[model samples]
Target: MQETLTRLTFPLSTTSAPCSEEEFVARFNQRPGKEARMGYDCPLCRNKEFVLRVENGFHRPYACRCVTIRQNLTRLRNRGLLELYERCTFENYHVTEEWQRGARDCALSFQKSPLDGWFFISGPSGCGKTHLCTAIASQLILSGHDVQIHRWVEWAAQAKAAVTDSGAYAALVQPLKDCEVLYLDDFLKVQHGTRPTAADIRLAFEVLDTRYNTPDKPVLLSSELSLRQIAALDEALAGRIAERSRNHAVQIGSAPGRNYRFK
Candidate 1:
């Protein structure tokens, strides 16, 4: 295994442009014919002695193209994108309303140059806020960064469970505090006609405060409430999010027609 690993040669970084599922399969599926194997060599395994070994009479294959491909795939999957593996990309997102178009542009810009800082997308329900945030998160993950996509309600549930066990809550939410990119979806998504309770606000404050104090971890946040509404809910927390967002923030809907869920 050590010899195989030492003989492997492939770009570990993921910088290639994103490809469609069909394109990806086609690119990797084109294998050389078996009859042409005499002079052929594996790009990653080098077709050398390290490519195979005999382990107690059993012929074991070591380094190969398949292993290299698996290693690359494992890195991408390790980004913690369980719920967002598909349909969470810039190409998958569609812009219908004027605000959604602007939001799409802003999301693409952030994907291209993420160092611009925290990106906040706020609006009414079904306004493509989550879609935009997911698109950005997908880009970051593909670019080889550790990213966490936390749902606000799910996280609040953890906070509820943590009322007695502080350690449990910390274990659940610590990834949000330290990931390379954190996408907090449906921020403060409380029931309709009711605002978040004091406990809810406190939970949000803790997470946002941790990220705010520890700089450079770009946050991609989306909510059914506008920035002003978030500020009205909790001034200090909103202030921290706003300060980091700066010009990168993109707000969507204001009134009823902006809701795109029905469409």
Candidate 2:
């Protein structure tokens, strides 16, 4: 009777503690953002990943303009596509040569397409390959696709370094193989503009083959080498990329005029 009376008088709470802001934002990054979900990452107000301003001198329980950039930064950090992310857009790509106009048009078309095939662009240095690739990635991101820009030269080195450990290697390479869209920047590029090594071929094949086999996975490849050049080095790998991108490939000629840095 005494125990029953105590239980009745002071019942345990049924509800859990409210979720923390950090925890909530982490979850939010992984899904489509909640509408009207307003917060900030200012350490002055709180730990920062996003919001930069408080509205009307009130704490940031309300949305502000900086949230968009904040959200973009958070998203880019979450994805592997961090560099050139803030600025790359269709509007930013300059149209100089007739080929540039064509390239821009091709990029826009790829951005607007159903995204069933790969996008391959090859050009000499300074042809804006990375810029165009990033522009496409930015658009896909806004559409809520999980996109990553794999800086092939740098990312490949990282993949090579991680090979010392099996789990670490997989963790590094897994995203390249599985992301919704992958922008492979500077594909098969090497120091002194030399051809890729055998190790490079193996690594490239591992990631490209997996994506190649999956018909629905869309890949964007930008290389200093043309498809013909890549095919010369490794036809099997180049064949997969070429076959997938046959519908949307752009190859800029290696004219001194094609390189804008000369001017």
* TM-scores for candidates 1 onward, in order: 0.67, 0.69
Q: Which candidate leads the pack in TM-score?
A: 2
Candidate 2, clashing residue pairs?
Answer: 41-48
Off by over 4 Å in 2: 1-72, 75-83, 257-263
lDDT string for model 1 (102-122, tens) is 778877877888867788888
Report model 2's TM-score to 2 decimal places.
0.69
RMSD of 1: 11.1
TM-score of 1: 0.67
lDDT, model 1:
0.68
Question: What lDDT is reached at residue 190 by model 1?
Answer: 83
- Candidate 2, 1-263: lDDT as tens digits: 34533342321133142664454434433343333322233332233223322233321232323444356557667765455665778898888688888888877888888376899998877778888888888777655466666678889988888888999999999988998788888998889837799889999999999999886789998998887888888899989988888777888877765622200
lDDT of each: 0.68, 0.71
